[model samples]
Target: MEPMDKDRRVPDRYEPGEGCLTTAVRLPVRIVVLVLVVPVRLVWDALAALGRAAHRTVLRPLGGGLAWLWRTLVVLPVAWTWRTLVVAPLGWLWRTLVVAPLGWLWRTLAVAPAVWLWRYVLTPVGRGIAWLVRGLGVALVWLGKALFVWPWVALWRYVLAPVGRGIGAVVAWLVRYLVVVPARWLYAHVLTPLGRGIAWLVRGLGTVLATLVRWIVVVPLVALWRHVLVPSGRVLAVVVTVVVREVGAAFGHCWRVAGIISRAVGRFLGTVLRWLFVEPVRWVYRTVLTPLGHGIRDGIWRPVRQALRTARETVRQTRRELRRALFGAPREPQPAAAVPPRREPGAPGTRTLGSSTTALTKD
Candidate 1:
């Protein structure tokens, strides 16, 4: 070999130039960013500007002019015409033609006649009628009292008192003979024996029930608890105790041995996994999967996500613009100033004609 080619420091494989690789990578990235990002940014800015211009120029002025025209042409004229032509004239005519004349006529024709009739004819006639009624009531009461007392006194003295005494004596004799003596005899002979026999039967039944309970239910339960259940429980407890003690001793002996074996096995398994599974997985993730994931995220997912965001923003802007073009931007309603209530003249606590008429009728 030649002297220059025999140098061990030099490699025989072709090595790529750093400048060429950098240029190749950077030019395409710059061109792609200019082509995609710049035009999208420009379009977004232009749409925003157009939306702002339309709102300020066309929609605002039209809304204001329409509001002004409505107030001037419809609202004001209607209010003024209703008040001047209808409400005020009708109220004045009602007061002048209907209310005043009716009030005067009522006072003159109805009130005067009523007062005069009450003072002259009605008062005298009522007094006379009252006197007549009082005389008639007094006569009736006197007649009723006389009629009631005479008959009652006569009947009591002659008929009722003697008859009632004889009847009462007979009733007493009947009750003493028929009811009292029979009740006493029956209670003493029949009811008392029946009650005694019932009490004896009840005592005997209770004693038998007690004996049956002791022999059948209570004795069996006591024998089972004393003889069978106690012995079985004791044997079960002894067996369980022996089993627990043997198990505990065996577990104690095996615990350290098991722990040692498990630790050795775990260490061996961990080393083998690290060499066979863990280390290979780590290398693959670091070298292949991580780079691939980064490439997919940065190159494909990032652009798709950015494009979706742009589309969403554009759709929102278009919808807003369309709504503005059709219905105009919504105006926030201003809070109305609170108006103090207007009190009408002579309205508060003032009675109408109908109420006055009701008062007269009541009186």
Candidate 2:
């Protein structure tokens, strides 16, 4: 290996050293944070667990049951009633009274006539009316041209146009001398300067007003906002940020602590339950109940079942003897092959005109 240089060295597992301020700050902060967080965390976790348990055990089932009951008892019945009593009757009445009559009337009167009129009567009549109206419109246009448009056109072109031209020339000349020249001169010489002075005064007044408004209203407001309100808001924001950060940190720590506590508690509870209830129950099942069940089975159940079987056999024998004594000994059943009377009757042939099925002919 190269000689280790003072400036260039291989780094190992690096552990950063903490300052005294950090070391002093961390322990008390952690202690204070733990103190603040623990109770809140425990309470929050407990309430949350309780809420979850309640929802699972009580609220969810209750809500489901209520929903089921509502659906079954109220919604189903109401829907059935509405469908059966109201909807069905309304549908029947609508079809029977409203739909049938209106459909028939519409089809018979309105639709049939409308169809006939549209197809046969109205089509030809409307075409004829359109043709007549078109011809009349042409004639009316000719008459209108003669009566109105031609007269106006002639008046404008022949008489009124020349008079209007002469009047326009005179008016233009008079207006140029009387109105236009004087107005242009007044605007250029008098009004322009006066407008410029008025505008300058208005601009100066506007500038003064702007300065006053800036000093009296805007500047102070700006200053107050910048110097006073801004600083205040910043301070409030810092305070709020610090409070929120601490609260957030506390909440996180509390949650972890609470979780640990909750786990410990749960373990303790589990242990207690195991030792107190589960172990005892298990022991009873193993030592007491199992032995008792076996004893009941071996000592009582088996012997009782065997005795019942013997009693049943004795009763069956007694019944058989009583039956034999009462009815005398039962004759043994004869074989069907040995007894011809016990054999089935043969199948009969179909009766015909030549065959007789009477008892007299039967063999």
lDDT accuracy of residue 351 in candidate 1: 45
Choose the strongest candidate by lDDT.
2
Q: How accurate is candidate 2 locally (lDDT)?
A: 0.79
Tens digits of lDDT, candidate 2, 101-206: 9999999989888888899998999999999999999999999999999899998999999999999999999999999999999999999999999999999999
lDDT of 1 by residue, 122-173 (tens): 9999999999999999999999989998889999999999999999999999
| Per-model CA lDDT versus the true structure | 0.76, 0.79
TM-score of every model versus the real structure: 0.37, 0.50
Worst 10 residues of 2 by lDDT: 1-10
